[model samples]
Target: MTSTALTDDMALRIGLAARALPDTSPARLLAVLADCIGLPPNAEKLDTLSIKQLRSGASGELADCDHSVLKTALAYLNGTASTESMPPPVPQSPLINASGSDPEGTIRVAIASNNGDLLDGHFGSCERFLVYQVSADQFRLIDCREIDDRQAEDDKNSYRAGLIADCQLLYVVSIGGPAAAKVVKRDIHPIKIPDGGAAPALIGELQQIIGAKTPPWLAKIMGQPAESRVRFKARALEE
Candidate 1:
């Protein structure tokens, strides 16, 4: 088989894995895999996949594939590739608080909801604020809001700053393109929330795994914590 054919086959397998996951983006999938493999945040380099390598089945460890097509597939999956060519560096800050009293330790998150309904229906009711606490046993919920509202203007900047600001992290619920663009422009890490069912559950599970708290609003909507379900696997794209 030619390198292109091998890549195509691998990509097909990975794509199939992704399709099994509902409301998951390739970027998010890649991020999950990267985290699992302990790869660096800036290691996504899939766009460089060549036709020669795709035809022959990947030999040895899948590291090359991991470094190339998988990374590219992730960028394509997350919808962040067009605006910025490279994946943003992972924020060097604590995603949660150690002490609720320490202002510096608080995980200041900006929940951007595209419409009031999604905010109201899915995120508003969850008791997810506890996930940000310093102690694993304790939890609390912070404020949640719509990005376009009157009060949100100032908060938006604050939220953007928090993503890169020392000890803060940003959480995005259902907002899209323009909003994502604004956040990314600030060099903040923006996590897109998946839709209902297993996706939300999977997110919650990952949050726990990462030792970060889920938003109180998200917890409430999810009702019950779901298992870890990876929607896609990295594969070299066909030439």
Candidate 2:
């Protein structure tokens, strides 16, 4: 092997050996090995000794040197080596509401509305729903879109079955009875909002309700007692 490769290999070997022994100094071990094999300027110089000299064993002091120094240095080196090379363990973040009686799983909430501005009003004439995952202090919006006639039907049935399969909570905000009826069979709790109110205002109002008397599904998803008031300023919808 080239000198660089040999040095790397030696370092890796020393590191591994130190880890295995847990009480050895890898430097000392390398120093002892270098001394016994007629390599370098002894234990003191082992740290800076080149791998080329170590592999060649061409140093002149190997014949007259005492073996006891090599042995003792090797032992001491093995013991101390581990401290320098070991990686620190990664720390984990604590889960929110870990002690709650709810099922050990994630909570999802779906908000269906007639407001087109929620999705930048892309589907101008269509209604939309925003699905979100509730956390201890915040809610993460996951999916938002307008569901067409066919898609609405499919989603109503499919969402119910899927949620039932996964045992997830389903919350639907609908404009009227027809759309609400589509998912009513799923036993989903429907929250009604005025078509005239802005999305942020509606959300703020709903948050207030949840904070005062949280619904069973919301309670599990939120995973924390709500303290702050939900507030927002109104914004005019674009034509």
| Highest-TM-score candidate | 2
Off by over 4 Å in 1: 1-106, 113-136, 145-167, 196-207, 211-239
Residue 66 of model 1 has an lDDT of 22
What does candidate 1's lDDT look like per residue over 49-89, in tens digits?
Answer: 33233222223222322232333334443333332212212
User: All models: lDDT?
Assistant: 0.34, 0.38
Task: Kindly report which residue stretches of model 2 are placed more than 4 angstroms away from their true locations once superposed.
Answer: 1-107, 113-125, 150-178, 211-239
Residues 1-239, model 2: lDDT tens digits: 32323344346645543322212345644554656443422335445444333333434322222232223223333343322322212222323465643333344545443333231111112234555544334444555543553443544444333332222343332223443454455555555432223444444445564544455455544454333112111111111
Q: In model 1, what lDDT does residue 64 have?
A: 27
